[model samples]
Target chain A: MDVGELVDRAREGQPRAVARLISLVEDAHPRLREVAAALTPHTGRARVIGLTGPPGVGKSTSTSMLLSALRAEGKRVGVLAIDPSSPFSGGALLGDRIRMTEHATDPGVFIRSMATRGHLGGLSWATPQAVRVLDAAGFDVVLIETVGVGQSEVDVVKLADTTVVLLAPGLGDGIQAAKAGVLEIADVFVVNKADRDGAETVVRDLKQMIAYARREIRGESWRQPIVRTVAARGEGAQDLVKALSEHHDWLVSHGELERRRAERAADEVAAIALRELQARLTDLHGGGHLPAVAKKVVERELDPYAAADELLAALRAGRG
Target chain B: MDVGELVDRAREGQPRAVARLISLVEDAHPRLREVAAALTPHTGRARVIGLTGPPGVGKSTSTSMLLSALRAEGKRVGVLAIDPSSPFSGGALLGDRIRMTEHATDPGVFIRSMATRGHLGGLSWATPQAVRVLDAAGFDVVLIETVGVGQSEVDVVKLADTTVVLLAPGLGDGIQAAKAGVLEIADVFVVNKADRDGAETVVRDLKQMIAYARREIRGESWRQPIVRTVAARGEGAQDLVKALSEHHDWLVSHGELERRRAERAADEVAAIALRELQARLTDLHGGGHLPAVAKKVVERELDPYAAADELLAALRAGRG
Candidate 1:
């Protein structure tokens, strides 16, 4: 139950310990800083892959296939599915959890789901911390699958080193993908469900889009590839894995991986600091200081901007 | 023009001046604090209404009908269509703009569209400030219409005094509404496109859900109303408006208005402070203070919590 033993067990691939660490992070426990400090030395080894697309695009199936492929290569894999779409939906409805039950008994595979149920500031606050916990737990690869319905996909981009944007054939997905703004965040484009009727058109459209994007991004080093896959049947899984490995190698050789990791760390630090500020502000509210300031603003005696400045000064004064 | 003149003109209900003020807020201009301070006294009069639902639920059409109905009652209205669903989709596709274009020259109506075309923190950060501008511009009713795809609706709840959740019949919208967590947030539920076959079923389902919710929520003051509307034909717009007015009265008489406004001011203050912290952090990054800390964390010499603490200390030192 001690932090030291939990960290030790997590590093030794104990699922219960890993789950506990993540729960501590999610709940923002008092000892969270201790857990992060303890886990820091063992982190930064996992390959974080983000899977995103429009709804019903087989993202979960693709993720499951990728997990199996990586495990076949003798790698320990962890899955973190961030479901921002479902309000009260959990564990059972997530396709990744349901479909990947075949690997439930495999000690090399671990899966966890994080859903947003009215959390302040939502997914961005807790995701990077959860990623760090998984990374420190000695997973060779961590797959992050998020429903690409809204801002969740954008948040996924900040955490994953390699982001694979999934797209299926029909439902006007080509235009939907462009409209949803996933074109810029994709490092590898997977046209899953390629056996469908309009799959070829989706593939063609993606290739053209990527071509135009490459021209627009002249100085960018890595060229994003479009791969076709029937992920449900496991066809083209090996090719997707190969493309991922090639992209990973390119990232390492070009030194972009280090830059990305540094940026991710900076974001994580900022998020943690902001959460701390919010908590401190909440304390001030409970103590009657913030309510008084807000009352003045609401009564038109003070402006919100000036009120915020006063609150910030109080926070600093308290810190001092 | 000077901020004083801009504030004066906006107060006088000049469209250009109001547009300029909102643009300044969207761009986070240097003089935003001044604008906020100036607009403080003129606000708190507008009845802020939020309209939200899933895609293809006729939210925009319903909004248009409501706008016309309010105008018939001699009310000046401002509409902010927060489209978090569409990235590049802006004012043109926003239903309030195109459907309400007949009111383009009506001095009593103003419409603005906000899309997340790569804006940092997106709509939630700027919405409260924008609402203040509209409120101060002498609009009797300010309607905020955000696509209820995900967390946007939750954010809308924080800013609006009356939230009207729209749902059409036969899209399984009843379940969708519950799944989107709108049941807890809806002050008035408007079933748009009620001429459809399953409209009564939708209304019945909503009533049952609300009844169950009321039982679960003991001591809640107000009961949510479900009104049917053929928005395209403007059949039930008056009833919807009446429902909104009743809810607003309830909010005022029950003293929930003050409580809600105070909480809103608190949120606005927190958002402004957080934005300032982010700007300061960006400056630190530019000045090498933050990147140095991030580097230490990335190199495993420092944990992220310690790095955040160091950065916060540097921020305090800068203030000193």
Candidate 2:
């Protein structure tokens, strides 16, 4: 089938077609540009929500609960679970796969896992493309879920319209949430397992922290709301949804949504250009200016900074 | 004085001069090429070691003990502690500084903390330059310690001749160490706080894990050694040093040291060139091909991949 037909079928909510397009993106297939070109007209309609937190903070539970809530509202939801794919997970990863079984059979729910183990371009390159695929497939809401407190989670924040940072009591995650710089990114903070003894304290602490951040700021900005949730029991899922909707409303009203989407597109464009440049440099590793400069730097005839300049000059000069 | 004078004084072992040069690196000063050129001949002498693991694993304590052990051998040590600078760790960060006060007054020790906050270049960009500064300053050993298990820690692995992954008993760190992909990077595993009850179990688990890893391998490789240490009391500092020395020796014997250094230099060159290209793209964002392409992509007249290709083509065409 042609790229046009695939995109047409994907927009008709055909799961197989959507998955095929994403695989094309992931693999950087030769025809990826064609597929993306065909899908572009249908993109940028879905609301992208990012869910991130440290491990053992019940991120998955909260995500599952949120999915059910969205589905109940008659919204088609797509989930992209970003797994670090640790070889050490052994059997635990399988356990996580089982937790999502509730939504596995739902036609409205399209769930997929993207592993970071072997991707050279990294999560930043693949994620936005997959998000576009889901968005083009006509999903109303796309949930981007990532575990741990790391740089990749930070990248996810850029793609999301509303970011929910989940924390639990007794995990010391409140402080971690602050330390990992997650506090600055969260649009809504959810204290999952709110029935626990210290869950209230977690909520109080998050509010105070947000207050402190607000005081440090000069201009008008969204004040992140903290909500209490017992996600395992689905108690506060409604409140969580409400907060998300409010944030989304604020984003749209403030004209920030357009700015954020433009920034995301700019970043995507820059990353692809960078990767292409890197590939070109790698291709010139032997019998080229790159190796010559590298050899000089390695032999102490020139420093890396100087070598880099010489290499860049050569690359530019060759354009002649 | 000028950068040349700073280089001269830094090479003469002036602590302030060394500190200033590193600050220039961290700041990405415009004359960075000049400084790197001056320091090239003096680089490659220091024994670079990377210490990393999850938070609350007593990484700082272990680092202090290792410093003392290396100091006892009459070696000059320069430590570049990569602090995540989490706003939540206002108190704990101070505690870490206090822990290193024992060697603060020693002329043989130079400890500097590099905060990741507000630095757009990131740890990877600044770290190798700082290491070059320390290496040129006559330090016999340079210790690069970073907290948390993430992508930055993986970057730390590339800069080290030997990487020691520190873990503590009862922290569930053994499994975490595996999950974070630190298992593959470790040349030596130090189980800090060996006097604790679960210390023996941690050691046993690590050995069995390493054994399992070895069984799956088809080629000859360095077998990671696990050493137990009560770092707070400095009980096993001797053994830790022994393990590091043995790993260093193996790195030399197998010629992996040369390969690693070449790879590091190659990465540095690529990073600098990428930064240059990114700067050019940013310049083009306002009135050139980048913004033009971005607008078309945003409007769905062109896809991001196609737009990126156009931008690259424009860059290449301009080089002509």
Candidate 3:
């Protein structure tokens, strides 16, 4: 249970060790910091990609196909599949990983599924940490896939170096708008199940959406590419891969990749801080001090802002 | 901005005081306890109802019709329409409130729209306080409507004495199974947009679903009432109202109303504690200690569990 040893073993390319270490992190083990500290300086080598969309949208299928294509090209690929947790069970619904059985024997591929145990964002607690694990494990490409909640896929934007939103045909316009906002974050948009009706419509809609996204980041240009694919058949897998390579080329050409990585690093710092604060706040509540404060707040003797200020001042005074 | 003064003014029917006080509570204003304490004893008097489902399920239209019907009966009703913050304006999507414009002049019916501000679980930080305000304002019933996020709908379940999940027809079998587990919490089931195709299939599925929900709570003898409604046209609205009434009667008959209220109060206690903890935990990461810890974690010299434990222990020991 000593987190330091686990981090050491995980870094030595031990799969079980890596998995166990991540479990500790997910449960908010106090030593998570030590593990992150060990892993932090070693990252920035892997290209982390994020894929997210509605439940039935064939994300898993596309991910499987992408894995095959990447590995065929002799790339060491690691997939961080963010799965949903069962509220009653407090464990992940591992159903999504059923399709990932093909590469179990392949040492060149590493797949880790992290449960979003009702975390507010679609991604889970240990995702960035796990990404670091994959990065240190020397994986050239890391793809993090999220089972997105309705109309909110913004979380992936913050997590991925290149965000891909996998959209199916037949979503119509308003639902498309909800997805439209998600599209703005997409470096590559794929209309999967292209054989289905309205594939062209989705592609056209994505183009219009890309136009809108472009206006926001005006003149600093690398257009969000729309790629069509039938993932099940691997029909357009090559084209999708080509689009990814071209997008990477475009990012390097425009100097956006380095800038984005810098932003992402800054975000990591903030997210870690936020995560730490959240844990302390939870502990304070579990202890006796907060409920009384809350009761007083509930009773109208205190207010939340004043309570927070008091708590913060107390924490600041207390932190050595 | 003293919430105590505002709560008192609001109690005295001062509109500005009411608006200002609710905003304070919504923002988790520090003096909330004082305001809430003043209003606490006024609650548990109204049968707070919650209406929730995905967007485009006619929740607003249903809310308007029910408010009008309740008003016709000469009863005071309060509607808390919850909308997500608009991506463009960073404010409540005011368009959601546009559906209820017909009752703008009706003093007997008060409709307020609040932003969720990215709170998952169908529970907003301001939700309970808003309900308390309406209750203290002497409304006979308070209906809090939310754009339900899947799985996270349990948040609304914690607040409502009766949770009504409005579902449209033809969401498909996969979604139906997804709804199966959550539907057990429902007191009255609604098939909104009953005129749409596959209404019968949805109702039939619910019947089968109730059988499972019933088995889960075998000792608790309650039959969930399923009502079909075309909310936009007011069709089946009366039956829906009747069903709600009968459900209330059943609650009283089974002595569940008091039990549910006690449960809800317990939940409020837990929620406050959890929020308090989250705030404190987040404080540690913000204190410039996390980056160091993350580096340690990444380096494999420290494991996450031990690191988390050490960090938390340090805080606790410092407290000592």
The best candidate in terms of DockQ: 1
Docking class for model 3 is incorrect
Compose the digit string of candidate 1's lDDT tens values, residues A1-320.
59999999998999999999988876778898899899999998999988887656787888889988999999999998887653322322453467878888999988988765555546776788888888998999999887665665467655889999887877542544364265667889898889889888878877777777667754687888888999889999999999999999999999999999998888788777767777788788888878889899999999988988998888888887
Question: Which prediction has more favorable DockQ, 2 or 3?
Answer: 2
For candidate 3, lDDT tens digit of each residue in B1-320? Answer: 56566667766656566667667666776677677667775656777888876555677888888887788788888888765432212122355578799998887777777765555322535677778788787778889886554344346545887888777775544234345444655678788888888888878877887887677655566677788988788888788778888888888898788667654543454455446554544565566454455455434455444455556565566456
Model 2, position B87, has a per-residue lDDT of: 36
lDDT of 3 by residue, A30-147 (tens): 6666666666556678888888765567888899999999999999888887654322211223555788889878878888877654563234345776787788667889998865
Question: Can you tell me which runs of candidate 1 are displaced by over 4 Å?
Answer: A85-97, A176-180, B85-97, B116-122, B172-180
- Ranked by DockQ, the better of candidates 1 and 3 is 1
lDDT of 2: 0.79
Model 1: per-residue lDDT, tens digit, B1-320? Answer: 59888999999999999999999877888898999988998998998999887666788888889999999999999998876653322323543457768878999999987654455546666888899999999999999987666665457655899888888776543554354266767889888888998888888877878887778764688999989899989899889989998999999999998999898888788778777877888888889987888899999999989998998888888988
Which numbered prediction scores highest in lDDT against the true structure? 1
Model 3, clash count?
73
Question: Clashes in model 1: which pairs?
Answer: none
Order of candidates by TM-score, top first? 1, 2, 3
**DockQ-derived CAPRI band for the predicted complex in model 2:** acceptable
In TM-score terms, candidate 1 sits at 0.94
Greater-DockQ candidate between 1 and 2 = 1
Question: Residues B183-257, candidate 2, lDDT per residue (tens digit)?
Answer: 677889888888888888888878777887788752557888889888889888999999999988888999988
Report the C-alpha displacement of residue B189, candidate 3, in angstroms. Answer: 2.4
